[model samples]
Target chain A: MTTTLTASKEQSCQTLLASGHTACTGCGEALAAKLVLGAAGSNVIVTDATGCLEVFTTRFPQSSWEVPFIHSLFENSAAVASGIEAALKSLGRQNEAKVIAQGGDGGTADIGLQALSGMLERGHDILYVCYDNEAYMNTGVQRSGLTPFDCMTTTSPYGEFSWGNKHNKKDMPGIAAAHNIPYVATASVSFPKDIENKVKKALSITGPKYLQIHSPCPLGWRSNPQLTITVARLAVQTGLYPIFEMENGKITKVRKVSTPKTPVEEYLKIQGRFAHLFKSPDGNEEIRKIQEIADRNIEKYGLA
Target chain B: MRLDLGAIAKAGTSKANQTCGWRNFKPIFHQEKCVGCGLCKIYCPEGCVTMVEKKKYTVDYTYCKGCGICAEECSSSDIEMVVEEK
Candidate 1:
């Protein structure tokens, strides 16, 4: 049962997502897209939102996708995917290809929320993936609904009067699971195998599924491009980004953090977005606040 | 009567657009020192790293953005990022 995605080192492998796109150097979204598509295999249809993922992959007469990919507006990819799924069902060929709708955090947790919720509520046989890099990376770094609390961005810049965003990060996976869908999972780019496994598991189950990947953005996050994997790994180790799977409105699995849990500073120090927290007089207080969030996650998921 | 959608592109035509010009650094694969971990193949955002054989890997420069991820993540440090001299 060796596919091109899971092909071992000795086997010849064919990636469904081709190379030579215009994504920023070491873009985590692009890497996650490749990993997801590879896991989905060639028999899948992808509908993309107008974000970095779509903008970079499809440029006029060039497309990095080897399989069928459709793009329209930023807020309607999930709707479009629903229509595609219905079309496949109407034609009695639903098994021919798996349907995937993808978007950035801005497109998913903000603008496209309505369509996504509709798709999930309607129980459409599709997989919706949100490549959450925290901010709107493509159209300059702006604060998004999924952006973490006290994170610096263009719209939520830290200043003498402000401490980054005033809102806490939206629990997207929890919202998706609240719909009582068949599956909802969170993964990070650090663990490519986790992503591959979750994608396969979500696709294997029927009905609507949602997968949110914590893809690290080097440019937007102001982190080192070469340390994209390192940043993603540290995020999970710090308990800032909990990896887990939910089935039938219940958490079925969780990736536990090893003993001597990594503090939030180790995760925050790598990204320039959190740099203001260390230099400002109110920085330590905010850092403590962030550590509380991680602590809550560790307690909630038993990731100690 | 007739539907007029926008222009259509062929599948995987992005391969035709060589991205090697974007690279300031080139990742040189030292096959002799390779440990066959396949970490480079998994981490490359460009998907340019390919496993040539067990304990061997090759990167396609034509599409390599030279982000240095492969070199930075190589298990055996078999992949080195060198300044691409014109």
Candidate 2:
């Protein structure tokens, strides 16, 4: 596959998310943000929350944001973005800039959910993207609400009697769709062109839009940095993560997986959080459950 | 198909508040020449690891914390560490 990042993307992509901003090598969140911003172009104002992406991309007096970006509080990015969009519209400057709110899973699925909900409900001609690494990675890998069941986190240690996490990931796209936004989609960093195209499509539309992008974390997920895109591809192939688009509160299309259902094990067996599954049979049931979830998702979204 | 301006107009009135977070860990296991002996279990801190009825084991990351202890105690070079994709 030829990634061949565009010159516009390469030139504008942050070589420095900040001079000394700290991010683990192969941080998917950072890459996803850079790509999305590059696609959105400089004619946009971004409201960001305090999360792994924000903390590592912008520090005092140093920032990789070549566009107009603001670091709002953790739970208020959507509200801030809404205000920015409103102000731009009222001032007849809407054409001067587009509005975007960004955050990681913690900020998007848990802490900032209310503000995000409000922003979507109000239909403020803005685009909100969630770069989901699936944990409170910035805060020492604590388990967040979006964490999958039995996945290990700092808070959820794999023990004899207890699994790491205990709940399914929240259906964020479903929630967004309920708002009846004109456009809602799921994307991943591995497919930059798809994400860029979706962003362009959203920009052309005249109402609120939502994009949930999968970003594979290296340190938190315990994988090789170079394999970020590979893991992303595996996720899509395994049906563990489905890429699709929803318009006007309905599913319109889904990205097809190139191969027959890849084993969830192929994807799971490569990560440290699931090492226990190889240790004993007890983990098999959970694996089956996860596979079932993915299979159901594939069936629902027609990813097969 | 014509773009639905009514849907666009309705999106403005629905009023949604929002926030987001992430919590997922990827697990890695090395399967080399070895007996299917499950010692990683007695040591797992999160109880996320377990064996299948007739096959290999599985990791329940909903509970696994990505600690390296299991890899550390592997009698065989059967389990390695892998980072989870976001």
Who wins the TM-score comparison? 1
Global lDDT of model 1 = 0.89
Query: For residues A1-304, what per-residue lDDT tens digits would candidate 2 score against the true structure?
Result: 2233332333233221222224454566766776676568767888888898776655443455556677759999999999999999999999998898998889999999999999998989999999899899988888887777678888888888777788888899898888888999999876766777888888889888999999888677877664666677788888888999999988888887656568899888877876777678888998998899888888889987
Instruction: Give the per-residue lDDT digits (tens) of candidate 1, residues A1-304.
Output: 1112333632222477889889888899999998898788889999998899999989989999999999999999999999999999999999899999999999999999999999999999999999999999999999999999989999999899988998999999998888999999999987877888899899999999999999999998999898898889888988999999999988899988856878899989989999999996679999999999999999998878
Best prediction by lDDT:
1
- Candidate 2: regions farther than 4 A off: A1-21, B1-86
The TM-score measured for candidate 1 stands at: 0.96
DockQ of 1: 0.66
The 10-residue segment with the lowest total lDDT in model 2 chain A: A11-20
Native-referenced TM-scores of chain A, all candidate models: 0.96, 0.93
Candidate 2, residue A137: the lDDT equals 91
Q: Where is the poorest 10-residue window by lDDT in model 2 chain B?
A: B11-20
Question: lDDT for model 2, on a 0 to 1 scale?
Answer: 0.71
